[model samples]
Target: MGKDNVTVLCNCATDEMVKDEALMDIVTTRKVIEFMEELCEREGYPKEVLTDNGAQFKSKEMEKYLSERSIDHKRVLKGKWEEEAWKERKGKCDDEAWKERKGKCEEEAWKERKGNCEEEAWKKRKGKCEEEAWKKRKGKCEEEAWKERKGKCDDEAWKERKGKCEEEAWKERKGNCEEEAWKKRKGKCEEEAWKERKGKCDDEAWKERKGKCDDEALKERKGNCEEEAWKERKGKCDDEAWKERKGKCDEEAWKERKGKCDEEAWKERKGKCK
Candidate 1:
């Protein structure tokens, strides 16, 4: 590395190459010294370093830093070929070359050639413009011719429109027919359903009436049993004994009358002496 601002630094060894590297912006002598100190602190010091006679490397601060760390610094003068080549090629872009090229043609002759070229270009452009105008007029005439032909075909157009209207009307009638059929089918289904429900209601009514008849028959049987028990007591005991056993008979009668007679009627009967 010569006397230049180094952005990147690297180290090459037998075991590792470029493993220990440092990067900096505009590497000055102070920055380079700081990096070296940090590197030595982290990875131990390097034995020797070789560099060119660059300004950053040959500075007094750089020398002091290396000496403090006991690092051997070698300096060599490096020649730059790119700078020399640029200096040699700098003389080729001179004012004399541009002056000779500018003075090659006379002013009057150049203006005459430019005017002739413009006149020829205008003639070609005018011919093309006239041709394009004629083509536009021809297109308009063809469009008018097509309109005249279409006017002669009005009879066929009327027939096509009439056919479409008839087809639409037919489709509407078919839809109405299907709708009527569906409504009739739905009404029949409803009627059958109502008949089934009526049959079930009649059966329920008959069952309810039959249950009431059975209850009446049970009450009649209980009355007959009470009559029979009275007859047996009359045949077995006297009038006084029959009167004494009447209270127990009343209790049995009350049990049989439950759910059969009205509440007020049963209460009145219970309060009677008989």
Candidate 2:
């Protein structure tokens, strides 16, 4: 019997007696195979095996094992056990025998009833059985209803959460993309501005250098022109002074020669008169 009060009965068909039994929290195909193997080893392999159409019994592994052992496998139809049992009982007993047994049971029941105590007991048992059956049916119905309602709630919650998550993800992605694009644009603009400024600075520096060079060249040319003019003026002054000195020396020599010629002429005249 399972925790849910579901019972599984495993037995052989020959004597309808349980040879071996196992209580498991969860029964699986592997466990079933092992159980059957142990049973076979103890009782020897049977010629045939009969079972219901359970997943563990009808599985490929079970079928293969049975086939390898040359065991004929049979499956009884589900929900027909009661009918089969009735048929078997009918085959074993005739109608006259059933009527005889029924009459004997009635007579015994009437004799056993002393002071309505057995009837009261029977009524109590019947009431208890009906109550248990009703409770079982109610529990099954409530469980199924709860499962259906829970399934719908879970689905709705999942869909709502999924939609919210997707929306958030899309927003985040969009924001990141926009931020990246803006950064790229700003970076390119700044880079272009920097390049333009650098080029302008280079041009300004070159112009300043050229202006200084031109000023130095002009100063050098002015210095050379002044030195050449000073040299020409000194040469002309020296030539004028040399010409004045030569003219004065020539005048003095001419005067001395004339005085000597006059003296010699006077001495010759005086000696002739004496």
Candidate 3:
């Protein structure tokens, strides 16, 4: 806070980060942390946070509170932007160097644009005293109490920053929504495929039962049918044999009657002749 003339203020819990100015984005972890801390300390915790990784910065107390609530925290990424590290390092030029370096790694990975004005301004304000740069000027800024007089001109910065901030935030939220939809659709498709496969397998199993079966079952049915046919044939043969036996008895009785009649006739004729 020394050379930075840093101001620490809280944001509203239900505040919408507006983007009316330009494509302004949250460029530092410290900014995000402060924003969240302000909300948490003021109003309440959210059930789900849809933001960039550094957008919802965490402190120990905040983390513990979020953990207790079992709130879902999703990270939304830009092409490569809203980097926190570089801002921390550049934001607080007179702050701790190690933290500044560590924080700038992500920013360095993604820097693509170059502007002469911005580059010169950042380099000039980086590690040098503003007094040194203004040495040639006749009129001077009052250096007596710098802390009490600095906040009067920060609104222009916020205005210029609004649009990009809104743009980055929207991208994050959209990405999260798309990811959820994709996952849900994927799960539903898998479930449908599984059901279709199960139905097909069940149909094939039923067809197999209607076609090929155990030979032993067929053999049992055939044995019962053959046994019944054999009994019917045996009964018919027995009835024909009984009729033939009755006819043979009738023929023998006829022969015996014929022999007895012939003997009586011969005896009568011999008596008449004598």
Order of candidates by TM-score, top first? Answer: 2, 1, 3
Q: How would you encode candidate 3's per-residue C-alpha lDDT over 149-266 as one tens digit per residue?
A: 5554455567657767887778888888888898889878978887898788778886776555645467767877787777788778777877787777777777777776776777
Question: What are the per-residue Cα lDDT tens digits for candidate 1 across 158-235?
Answer: 778778878887888887887888788878887788778778877887788788778878877887888889887776
Residue-level error in angstroms, candidate 1, position 53: 86
lDDT of 2 at 160: 91
Best-to-worst lDDT order: 2, 1, 3
TM-score of each: 0.24, 0.33, 0.22
**N/CA/C clash count, model 1:** 1
Per-candidate Cα lDDT values, in order, are: 0.64, 0.70, 0.56
Q: Per-candidate RMSD vs. true structure? A: 33.4, 30.6, 48.8
- RMSD (CA, Å), candidate 3 to true, equals 48.8
In model 2, what is the error at residue 204, expressed in angstroms?
4.7
Superposition TM-score, candidate 3 onto the true structure: 0.22
Prediction 1 global C-alpha lDDT: 0.64
Candidate 2 or 1, higher TM-score: 2
How many steric clashes between backbone atoms does each model show?
Answer: 1, 0, 10
